[model samples]
Target chain A: MALVDDNLTAAGVAMEGEVSDYLALLKPRVMSLVVFTAAAGLLVAPGPIHPFVAAIAILCIAVGAGASGALNMWYDADIDAIMSRTRNRPIPSGRLDRQTALMFGLVLSVFSVALLGLAANWFAAGLLAFTIFFYAVIYTMWLKRATPQNIVIGGAAGAFPPMVGWAAVTGNISLDSVVLFLIIFLWTPPHFWALALYKQSDYAAAGIPMMPNVAGERSTRNQILVYAILLSLASLLPLATGLTGWVYAVPAIGLGLVFSGLAFKLWRAPAEQMKRNARELFTFSLLYLFALFLALVADVGIARFLEMIS
Target chain B: MTAPTEPEMLSKEDSDKLAKSRRGRSIALALVLGALAIVFYALTIVKMGPGVFNRPL
Candidate 1:
């Protein structure tokens, strides 16, 4: 019995160091968001792409996003090991070695960018390469430890995917894609500040200069409110530009209001309920972005259906 | 000269486990390399298009 128990424990420990460990290095949740937004951009663009080509482009974008995630994990492993929220990440948990993760990330980055250039166009591929560099080098290595404005600037990396998708289809960016980018860029600060409000100690412990840590909670809350109001207006730009119609506008306005309302509530919450309020705002922010994007896609789909019937 | 020193022996279960792990790693590496080869080959086909065989001498 003792021998079997010992073997079982050994097996369990060994199982932790598997292919899944390497996959976890990719940060799959973030990759999913990138994929969804990229696909929406592709679908809404004013060009026809073969389904196979579309699939290949989206795959390359997802792989490129994954590559950036892996590189970030490789670079941030030390701080990840220190933070309670991130201590169980692949590198921090000792499931994957740092050198192996670094090499894996580098190889994936090259492969993803090259494949995207072949599958789509050089413009989209260039954007992917730049996004990876911006996230792994600019954000993770420099701004993360240096300034409270890290999220505001680092948000550019995440906001580039839809534009890349647009370029993949159109071979150029237009005002429509820029509006998509701006919506995400404006939305990022408040979304991240809400989480930072609740995870203040984790950021402090990790030596990261997240807004709530460098600035007081009052300042952070005020900034979140300000960004929320800006984001609410920015979300309506697609409607104003006629890229999307009322189908998208109604939800954009409604969800934007809800998001701003949550931010205001968080700003006004008592000290005792601050954590709960921040968490609520963080959760709602995710829904707000997703619903906004989905509304755009739906508006396009509905217009196409009507045209076909007419 | 003395006989060559015998190699350290592993227990039967330990040796079996080691063999399995090595096999798994080998297969994984081979799959990755094979996939890379296929992707590069596809890119070549896309780049050359249908004109590769029809080019003039």
Candidate 2:
């Protein structure tokens, strides 16, 4: 019995985190969005790539994105602990230690970049490496704390995945990929600002300098409306560039109108209704981006089907 | 140098939970490694083609 007690005590000293806790460090929801947009970029790019290579490229990209998330969680664990929304994260909740998270992220980042270079082209690998660095070092450590424009610039990190995906296939950047990057880049401000509007207290408490915390809510609302209009216009560029046809154009126009309308509503919302309006815009913004990307992919698929039949 | 502190004792339930967690991590690690091996193997076949088998010994 004494030996059993001693062994249990030894086990207790070393807190082994569950696999799910480690996965939580990866921010799976964000990873899903990264994967979807990256896959869209890969599929929509005009090229013949080995399906196997395509799968490997996407896997590497997902792992790299998840690696960045882990690094972000490790660095932001302090502010994360202060915010109710992030208080339950692995590090903040003490399910995993920060050092472990850092090491996990570093290892995965190296592996993902190296393997992508081997499986795909070096250009795509370089983009992935830059993306990880941008998110982990630039956005998380620097921009996030220092400036109100954090999300505006940090949004570039998230915007790179699809471009990376396109590069994986074409081995070069093109106007179409740039247009895809622009759509996400412009969409990010309004999307994140709306969330900040409702969660102003969280950012204030965490000293995050989010737009709504740094700028007044009214200023943030106006900026969100402007960005929403810009994003809508940018979303139609695929059609203008002849990268996509009417299949993409029709949905793009409709989605852009709805997105801008929500932003307009939020801008004019009464103080009492501000949070609800912001939340509605935030929720719809996600659907809007997802639908827009889905439409792009669907347009490509339909075009391919028509070409094959003809 | 600081003296080593005694380890804290855990209840049987906590010990069991830790053991389960450790096992789960091991399984996940194994699956990831397996998937990686498959990826490399497929990549080799795709890149090298029948030439993979024809390499000089």
Q: Identify the leading candidate in terms of lDDT.
A: 2
Which candidate ranks first by DockQ, i.e. highest?
Answer: 2
Clashing pairs in 1: none
The recovered share of true contacts, given per candidate in order, is 0.04, 0.82
**Could you give the C-alpha RMSD of every candidate to the true structure, in order shown?**
5.4, 2.5
- Runs in model 1 deviating more than 4 A are A1-16, B1-57
Docking class of 2: medium
For residues A1-310, write the lDDT of model 2, one tens digit per residue. 5775565665443445889988998899999999999999999999998999999999999999999999999899999999999999988988788899999999999999999999999999999999999999999999999999999999999999999999999999999999999999999999999999989999999999998887899999999999999999999899988888989999999999999999999999999999999999999988998999999999999999999999
DockQ of every predicted complex: 0.14, 0.63
Worst 10 residues of 2 chain A by lDDT: A7-16
What lDDT score belongs to each candidate, Candidate 1 first? 0.87, 0.93
Q: How is the predicted docking of candidate 1 categorized under the CAPRI scheme?
A: incorrect
